[model samples]
Every structure is written in C-alpha cells, then in structure tokens.
Target: MNCKFLAIAVAVILFCRPGHAQTGATVLDDFKPSSLNQPGQEYPQVNSQGYVRFRIEAPKAQSVVVSLGLGGTRGGTPLTKGTDSIWTGTTAGPMEEGFHYYHVTIDGGVFNDPGALNFYG
Candidate 1:
C-alpha cells in the first residue's frame, strides 16, 4: 500500500507539470508566444478556449487526422484540408492552456505531432 501511494504521488506531480515539460523546454518558448495570434484572426495559435492546432507541410493527403496523444485519441478529430494542403481543427477540451502531445494521421493512420512536445499522460 505504501509503495502504491508513493508511486501515485510521483505520477501526480509529473502530470501536474505543464504539458511541455516532456520536451525539456518551456511550452511558451515551444509555441512561439509572439505567434499566439495574428491581428484579426479567428483563433489563436495557442488558445485556452480551444485545443492545440497545427498544420503539416506535406502534399495533399487522401485523408488526415491529428491524434492528441502520442498514440492517438481513441476517437480524435479528423483533419480537413485547408488551402495548400494545410489541415486544421480543435479538440474536445478540458485542456489547460499549455503544450500537449499530438501527431498527424494521414489516410486513417497515426503519427507523432512532430512540431509539438509529446507526453504519455
């Protein structure tokens, strides 16, 4: 029981740390604070009200899904093509304003969010 409690406590402390700690850098620096939002933009590059957003610099895909976890959200949002093969969308949140892990999925597959820091949760 004591061992279990100790392990639990350690896990809690690590989980409480800002989601970007996995990268060994600050989330603010990771996200480029200055690029949080552009003048007259619909959403922020980083947002509290919405989830993290990203775009890939790849040619148009037959399909794409941005998985929230290192693996993928059991059921995550699928990416819709934006102009120039850019994909965009938000996640089901309850997420605090900070960095989180994610990956891109092309054609019903999952990939790590190469641009963002990743955590196992």
Candidate 2:
C-alpha cells in the first residue's frame, strides 16, 4: 500500500541524514592566536567561542599539562603527546573573556609558555 511505501521512505530519509543525533552544543570553527602571544607564536590560541587551545613541544617529557581556565577536579587540561613529540589539548569548555594567568607543567615542573608573553605574576 502507499502508506507502507511512505513509511519506508520516511525511515530511509531519517536514517540517511548527515551525522548522528547530537546532544551537545556545537563549537564554532573560529579560532585565532591570542593577542598575548609572542611574536609569530601560534600555539596559545583563543576561539571566538572562548575555548582555548594549547600546543607545546617537548620530546623528552613524560607528561605535559596546561594550568589555565580548565574547570574540574583535575584543575587543568592535560595535553596528549603526538608522534611529533608535541603535546596538545583544548579546554573542556569556553573560558571567560579576559586576561588570565597560566603556565605549563612538564614532568611535574612548572614553566611559562614560550609562545605566550610572560607576565610577572
């Protein structure tokens, strides 16, 4: 019957739609290097949505972390090392729009981000 064919068509259309049903807010693809970055630096960038992304390079380091605007029990966004020996990660959520102090933790030692301009805080 036409009803049966119509039902099948509707099911196919629903199933073939692009992307799975998402239950989360979408992050816009608008990110740029922060104004506080050192000349020609690009790692410490901020997006229009206020999310912060960090990238650090340390080949011999066991672990790397950014003590920035991350909000959780861990207190920071942990960077995962890639094959290129650079560590990178993004904040779980958007950060407040303003100046904030942060540092990198490499193998349990705190160090300033070379890409970012250092503030004597």
What is the TM-score (0 to 1) of candidate 2?
0.76
Model 1 residue 103 CA deviation (Å) reads 2.4
lDDT for each candidate structure: 0.53, 0.85
Candidate 1 TM-score versus the reference: 0.47
Range of the 10 consecutive residues with the lowest summed lDDT in candidate 1: 25-34
Candidate 1: clashing residue pairs, number: 3
| Runs of candidate 2 exceeding 4 Å displacement | 1-23
Q: Write the per-residue lDDT of candidate 1 for residues 1-121, one digit (tens) a residue.
A: 9999999999998677664323332233122221333443432245433345555545657876666532244456565677777676544342455555556778766776545444577
Per-residue error for 12 in candidate 2, Å, reads 49
Q: In model 2, how large is the Cα lDDT of residue 100?
A: 90
Off by over 4 Å in 1: 1-44, 69-74, 97-99, 118-121
> In order, how many clashes per candidate?
3, 0
Alpha-carbon TM-score of each model against the true structure? 0.47, 0.76
